[model samples]
Target: MSEESGSLNTTAAVGEKINAISDGSQIISAGRAISALVSEYVQESYCYRWLTKEPDPDVIVIDLRETYAFGPFITLLDQLVPHIEDAWQHSRVGAAAERVFKRLVEDVFAPLSETRGYELAAAMLAPPEPPERRNATVDDSESTEDELS
Candidate 1:
């Protein structure tokens, strides 16, 4: 069969139970499927590392940058956002999925982003702080305290 017809056959072959579902149910089910996919994807790839809250920012960014995750994640999120918004405006199950999606963004994703670790990757890689700032608490002025008194 041609590619288009092949895809139609595959879709139609989901079994009679799914074929009998209403359009609203299909949309809702799709939303839940998407939500589960995203959740599993993030947890397996990103969230587990993130939730560690590693002490060193360099370590965190280095871990995250592995396999070039950041760029693709941004792309996926951008594409998903519009679909999620449309789902929210469409059906009750979609609305519930939207809530789950929003919580994922706000509670988990936002804090990870606000850490600003990605932006600091370079600074973390750079050489240590200059000598002058090392003992900043020490008074290094030309005049001593005795002279000032």
Candidate 2:
């Protein structure tokens, strides 16, 4: 098979794995999942170059955030957060999972934050804000303006 087809096959496999994890059909720990995702998906994408580039961190983060790969990874990370704790509690996989997660945080994310800035790393690692909270803030401001008038 051609290289492109192989890549596509790999991508599809990764996607299935991610979906399985999301649906709880697969019992892999978050760290393993994350490692697979980064190596198999993110590293092969356009963002990898910018992620490893020596230029400004914020610029790299910003550029990467706009790419197609960024959002899904962010979403996946958010989903994986709960699993990390659960995996850590299991004896069989706990130690290994923790080690992998820690390395991803330290080796991958920490360096990104240290070299680039916190924005991209934070965006990748942070849980997304709920829509209701955002809407409430906007509504509060609107109400305050009415009271002032």
Candidate 3:
């Protein structure tokens, strides 16, 4: 099959798996498939090479936004959010899937400045900080201030 046809087939397969996910194991499996597809795309795309060579954060950000492959990649990743959340509630596989997903995103954007890379990856994959944790941190800081006073 032509490369484009092969890629489409792979994407379709992954999409089907994503839609069919009913448990944490399936979520992890789908995530792995996505990582593989993204890895292949990065290895073959000019954007990766350009990202490696480019030094300017502004330029990197612009190119990332403008690249033809980026839009579809982002969309694919976006589709995983709800599934990941559902998986998190029931099994340990959510953590595994999260690690794989985060690593995949970080690797793709690693060529950019650390801050920029993190910003982009966090934007794409970082789950919101749990409200309880946020509140605990705030309470701790307030207590510390009271003690100091």
Q: State each model's CA lDDT, in order.
A: 0.76, 0.81, 0.81
lDDT of 2 by residue, 53-137 (tens): 7877665336554569787788788799889877668766887877899989988877777765577666788988899999999
- Model 1 segments more than 4 A misplaced: 1-88, 121-149
Question: What is the RMSD of candidate 3?
Answer: 27.8
Cα lDDT tens digits for candidate 3, 1-149: 69999999999999888766644576678988999999999988998887777577765336554569797787777799888878786777867887888997788656554686677977889799999999999999999999999
Estimate the lDDT of model 1: 0.76
Query: Whose TM-score is higher: candidate 1's or candidate 2's?
Result: 2
**TM value for model 3:** 0.24
Report the lDDT tens digits of candidate 1 across residue range 44-146.
Answer: 8866777866677555435443458686787788899999888769989987988999999999987776676854875688899777776663555434665
Candidate 1 least-lDDT 10 residues: 58-67
Tell me which of candidates 1 and 3 scores higher on TM-score: 3
How high is the lDDT of residue 133 in model 2? Answer: 100
TM-score winner, 2 or 3:
2
Estimate the TM-score for candidate 1.
0.22
Best by TM-score: 2
TM-score attained by model 2 = 0.25
